[model samples]
Target: MNYPFEKVADGAEETKLIAEEFAEELNGGDLVLFHGNLGSGKTFFVRSVCSALGIDGVTSPTFSLVNEYHGEKKVFHIDLYRIEKADEFENIGLYDYLSDEDAVKFVEWAELFPEQLKDYDFLITIEYIDDNKRKIKIERK
Candidate 1:
């Protein structure tokens, strides 16, 4: 599907501004799926969002798989980079995070489990254009 909202982030500052604006759309029960290639600034975007939400010390959940933060609203950050199958997702108890009605979810590598996206509200795609350039597309589904 073609996303209606597209923005070019010229650098980290621009990306942070964009992320701050995007975070304004979040509320409880919101799920955001982040799609991007490695080093494409997905984590950077997440950090910006968390910061805007009043959550501090945001980091990639690569090794831990999921990270939870409490701010104006609860935020759940899930990284599925290590998950290769549905069984792995189930084993990790991701459903608990996905079903939490009081938390906003930002899922990285969520494209791995398309079938479990019934509760998702947004899809964000970040594409690398150059060393300091990125194309970010936000779509509602």
Candidate 2:
């Protein structure tokens, strides 16, 4: 539960750079859960990761709930912000994305269903300190 990999992003540029580097370490079937408040750079990090993985047009899936991308590896960007219950996630087939053996999944607003998300590759927490300052902590689970 200790986050040994922690980075302080002074601005969006640094955050993007961290995400790009983080993307390089990902392999297929990696599950990354993002924990942060709204506008705390969760989506921004996802965008950077997707871009580094050669996926284009990466956007926040707040409304759509899930976004799929095909890059060096298949990637699933899931936003659970609109999800109010665990059953909602199950009903929408979000688990289908996690079941992919050859894909990487990044989930935002993952705190909503912590019980169901105990098993994961990495858990990312982005804490917003100021307008352009964020503390990102990556913990391996």
Candidate 3:
């Protein structure tokens, strides 16, 4: 399915619904790269996606680098918030996660290492607006 950039300025529930839609349409081996400022609901969107995929308790892997949730499907949530350089992801075994059997990868702060995103399937960008609203864009490049 071709999902153009979608807007979700309604509420948090609306944001989650958008994530659910992406989850339903997403296939195995898909890589989702998230771009936005801090507190822009990147992790929130990821959490909802994981939840929709039958996983639970999706959290940011800030200190741990990566967190894995296992259920009907697996979710690999990677956070590059503390990385000083782009090469740090390689040292953290990014390629291994990518090769893991059909697990979905949700990455935050991806724009910091644009070169690393070449293999990604989709780019999800979320921008916050007034009154608990968010402008979300999901596109394939």
Task: Tell me the alpha-carbon RMSD of every candidate.
Answer: 2.1, 1.9, 1.5
Candidate 2: residue 89 Cα off by (Å): 2.0
lDDT of 1 by residue, 24-128 (tens): 888898999998999999999999999999998999999999999999999999999998878876788998889999999999987778888766799999999
Q: Ranking under TM-score, best-scoring first?
A: 2, 1, 3
| Candidate that would win on lDDT | 2
Worst 10 residues of 1 by lDDT: 1-10
Query: Candidate 3: which stretches are off by over 4 Å?
Result: none
Report the candidate with higher TM-score, 1 versus 2: 2
Model 2 residue 30 CA deviation in Å: 0.7
The lDDT of each candidate is 0.90, 0.91, 0.84
Q: Which one wins by lDDT: 2 or 3? A: 2
Q: Tell me the tens digit of each residue's lDDT in model 2 across 11-102.
A: 99999998887898798999999999999999999999988989878999999999999989999999999998888867899888878889
- Residue 86 displacement in candidate 2 (angstroms): 0.6
Q: Which stretches of candidate 2 lie over 4 Å from their true place?
A: 1-3
Please write out the lDDT profile of model 3 over residues 11-71, one tens digit for every residue: 8899998888788877777888999988899989998988888888777787898998876
| Pairs of residues at least 3 apart in sequence or in different chains that clash in candidate 1 | none
